[model samples]
Every structure is written in structure tokens, then in C-alpha cells.
Target: MIDDSRTRVLARPFPPRRCQALFALVAIAFLAAPAAAAVHPGQAELVREVARDTGKDPAALDALLDRAQKQQSILDAIGRPAEAKPWSAYRPIFLTEQRIDDGIDFYRAHRALLEQVGRRYGVEPAYIVAILGVETSYGRVTGRYKVLDALVTLAFYYPPRAAFFREQLKTLLELPADHLAGPLDTLTGSYAGAQGWGQFMPSSIRDFGVDADGDGRIDLQGSLPDILSSVANYFARHGWQAGGPVAARAQPDAAARPIEAKDARPQWPLEQLEAWGYAPLQPFNPGEPAGLQTLAGANGPEYWFTFGNFYVITRYNRSPLYAMAVHQLAQAIEAGAGPADPAP
Candidate 1:
């Protein structure tokens, strides 16, 4: 799955505007800014709004404001341009022998939990492992950026999607103490505020988040149970179908021409797409719904009939590249290392 386990869960937030990750820590800068200037355009107002929404005393918001302001620089530093290179370059950075080795090791270590989560969530362990592989290399590389700083920077300073980040900040503030697990421990992830092995943002951490360990709290960092469970919960919530095929190889029709995927929501239907020569090796149940997804390959082109489950994977990350990477990575993990338990 593309994991919104990075993008999908985080999607509930408002769309991004156009803020880029700056190298410096904006959190420190926000606090150090001259006492006179308003560091964020609507920060104070936002705090008040949060207070009104959550019924928390406005005074309690001071800490939140301080935290948000202090972390602005961190968000600015997230999503480094250096890290945004083309997939040809980015793919090699992650699809390494070490990653493959680590994927094997991760699968071996969490065999039981992976299987259990898979069974309960109706998602395949391979897909989950692939997500971990692509997102953080089996948790070996879950970003060093402090989540608070990243979220706040994107929320307040990043104009393109400040509203979305603001919502994440609000979610972070409203997280129950049970899920908080103390502030310092939860402060790390991708530049966009995704956290844990699955790189879930705060709101996702709250809504689709699951307490895998059954400790009565979901702690993405410390507990594998919680992390795996949270991932499974994310897929389930996004409409993952147990035992359903995620993708299928297809040959396009003579008239089938490459078309760009829509920028907004996906509403295209499979039956209509058949006119374009998108036929699969195995006939899917006609009753099932599907979509058209064409991809560029190393040589020429690749096409697949994406189903609802495949679309659910995209919720983790919007890019078809991201979804494909996860799908391929999961396949690799399955080939390189066997599952921890007998297939259910």
C-alpha cells in the first residue's frame, strides 16, 4: 500500500499550499524572533479557536503555542529538496541490499505480530512490510526530524498547506495523554509530520490509530504491536479487502493512449476503462469496482487495473510511484524472506 499510513490519513487535513522544507530549525527561530513581530499570521487566533473547540482553558494553549512556534524551523527543514530527487535516483537510495536484508530481518523478528495484525486487519503482512520498507526501511530510518517542529512549520509557516498542518497541530494538542506517551518520545518522523515505522501523522495517529499491544494506548515508537496494529487499522479504515488482489497486469487496447491521473479524487470506473484496451490476465469479478493506472517503467510503459484495495494503498501516499514502490517492495520482501507464519 502507498501507506497514507503517510498521505491518506494525513489527507483529512486541508490541502497543502506550496511551502518547501528549509534547512534551518524554524522552531528555535520562532521563539527567538524579536518579541515584537507576530511569528505566525494566525497563530494566536488558532490557539483561541482550538481552545474553543476542545473546551481547554486558553491558558493551557500557551504551552501549545510555544511548542508550535518553537518548532516552526523544524517543519521548514523537512522534505529536503535533496531528498525529492526523481524516483530513478530515490529508488536506489531505498532499494538496497541492506534494506532487503533489513526487511528480511524485520519480517523474521515480528513474524507473529505481523501475522496476527494481518489476520485481524484483513491486510497482507507483505504489504505492511513493504510499507515499512519504503517509508522507513523497516523503521531503521524513520526521519530524525522532530514531528512537533515539522507539523508546526508546515502548519504555520508553510503557506501552501498551513491549514492542514494547523489541523495536525490541533490534533497533536488534543491527543489524549494515553496516546501522548510523554511528549519527547513521540517527536520524530518524516518532514510532513508522519510518525513511526508507518510514518503516520498525528491525526492519523488519533483517528485510524490502534493500540496493537493492547496496552490501552497507541504508542507508535516504542511498541511494535502498536505500530503494526496502527498500520493494519489504517488499511482497514481505508477499505482494504481481505484476500483481494491489489493489482493486475494488463495490456492496453490499440486505441489506448496514456493519460494523466486526475489531480483530485479518483472517480473513474473500470468497466468504462475497458474500452481503452485495459484487460487483465485474470478476469476480476465484473461486480467488483476498479480504476485505470498507467505507469512509466525503466524501459517503456506499464499498466495495471487498480482495484479499491489498490486505491486504499494510495491513501498512504498519493503518487502512483509511491503506491507502485510499496507494491513492488512488498513483492521483494515476499521473495527475499518468507512470512513469519503459514499463510492464513
Candidate 2:
């Protein structure tokens, strides 16, 4: 949701001294307030709804809310997600040689399990590894904020997406009480409440998570099998066509018209796009649905004729830049893994 208003916040330059002073004040304000008195405005309604939905005790839910502290930092982070960056700046962050190397290492380390799940789910191991690398650097940086605090803060205080986060909070509450070994308030995740190696939101975990290792429990944080299988299952459920092209270089004809939607869903057929002056370098099925995307790069604008697989990737993340990064990173990892790596 980084629109013009959020862009202004990101672009605004603040002096170090002023930033330090402002942070200090905010910190002091947060620290001075007791947790018992830190209830969000919509806490009661949230408690009632969650209690009704999950059949949990209202007092218990209320106590969780009372103990949850509001984090302004989460709000600040949400306002400036990585997807907000232009493709020029966004490409380098995920397309580094180091990330690709790490992805290769990750793929090799879990090659057997990944291959097993890939075969079952019809997903490539490199793509799964690339998602892990891009999401949390293969769990090296899976966030540190308490999941409860992040979700509650965003659910009540953040107006733009409050309803969405509220739904996620409900899903988190509705999870089996013993899903996690520890207390709910102790679970840690991204500022937006995405958790574990795959950075899945609560709803996604509930929907797509699987116990791949057959341990009778789904532990995304500690179980590599579950993480890999969950990612593959998510892709398969989202209609990831096996062996389909994700994207291809395209030369836009001079008379090409700009696409109407900025989002990456496949709205145009290949034949229609070709008629509209976007021609792919490789021959493609004319009946297949596709879209033309122009990415701003350091050199210039690069165009691509994206296919349905590309659209499916976008379901995991709405940004076309993110989808492309994952696609390219997967390709790089496959290339780096050499001929020894198993093919999809």
C-alpha cells in the first residue's frame, strides 16, 4: 500500500539529531505507560469477536490484549515495505551474488527433502529455495517482533489494512491452542505478522501449511520439511502450472499500448498482446493468457511478456518486481547449482 503518501514519507530526509530525539521521545512515551493500561481502542470489540469465533474465554483474550504493547516501529516499517522501491533499486537487493550462493547452499543442504516435496507438489526445488532466500535469507532474518504485538498494533491502529490484519489475528487465535509449544504472545515474526522461514501470514499458514515430516505437528520455525512442503503446496494450490514459462524477454513494438492494470495478473492473451505490439523472443502458445510488463532498470526500461506462472507467483506476493526477483533468483540458483542439480 505504498502509494504517493507513503512515498513522500520514504523520500523525506530527516536530520540524524532530530531523528534520534524523536525516537527517544517516542521510546520514553512507550516505556512510561504501563502494559495494563496499554489497551488499543478497538480491544473490546476484537476480544468479543475473537472469543465468539474461537470459543475462547473473553477474559483470557482481554488479558492478552492488555499485556500486548503497541509498537510504533511496526507501523513505520509497514509504511515502507521493500516492494515500494522502484525495480531499479529493488533488483539489486534480492539479486545479489551472495543471495544466489546462499540459495545454492540451502538447496544442496536440503536437496533430498526439497526434491521429495518438489516431486510430490510438482514445484521446482530452486524456486522453493529462492523463496526462502528472498523471504528471510533462508531463516537468517525471520524478524524478531512478537507476532501478537505486531498483529494487534496493525489490526487496530493501522486504518488502511486494519480489517485484513484483524482477520489474520482471528486466524491466529483460531489455530489449535497447542499449535505452538509456547504462549501465543511469545511468537515472533515480521512487523506485518508474517512468520517463520517462508514468512507466511497466519491465514496462509492455516490454509497451506502441512506436516511434511509426518511429526503430527506443523512447526514452520523449526521444521525444514514443513517449511519446504508448505511453500510448494502454496504454489501448487495457487495454480502454478508445471513446466510453464514464468516470463520471457519481449521487444515492444513502437505502436504498443500501455497495459491498463499495474498489477501482474494475466489479463491479455498472447495473441492479443502480440497484436498490441508486444512480441516475445520465444514462440509461445497463442491461446495462453499473458501480460506485458515494463520494469525500470539501471540501464533502461526492460520489457517482458509474462505468463500465467508469473501471475501465480504474484499471488504469493502482489508485486511484479517481487515475482520477477523470485523467478530470476530461482534461475540463478539453478544455474549456480550446475549440472549436478536435479532437473524439475
Best by TM-score: 2
lDDT at 309 for candidate 2? 84
lDDT of 1 by residue, 153-236 (tens): 787778777788889878887777777545733477777878888898888888887876778878887788888888888899
lDDT of 2 at 206: 88
Spell out the clash pairs found in candidate 2: none
For each candidate, the alpha-carbon lDDT, in order, equals 0.73, 0.87
**Worst lDDT window (10 residues) for model 2?**
174-183
Name the candidate that leads on lDDT.
2
Instruction: Give the per-residue lDDT of model 2 (tens digit) for 1-344.
Output: 54698789889989999999999999999999876633788878877887887789988888887877789999999999998888999999999989999998887777788888889999988899989999999999999999999999999899999999999987888788535525688789899988889999988988899887787877888899889999999999999887888998888878988875677778878899889888878888998888888888888989988888888889989999999999999999988876454567
Which run of 10 residues does model 1 get worst, by summed lDDT?
A: 15-24
Stretches of candidate 1 off by over 4 Å are 1-39, 67-90, 184-186, 263-272, 339-344
Model 2 lDDT, residue 76, Cα = 98
Candidate 2 — which residues are off by over 4 angstroms?
1-38, 341-344
lDDT of 2 at 167: 90
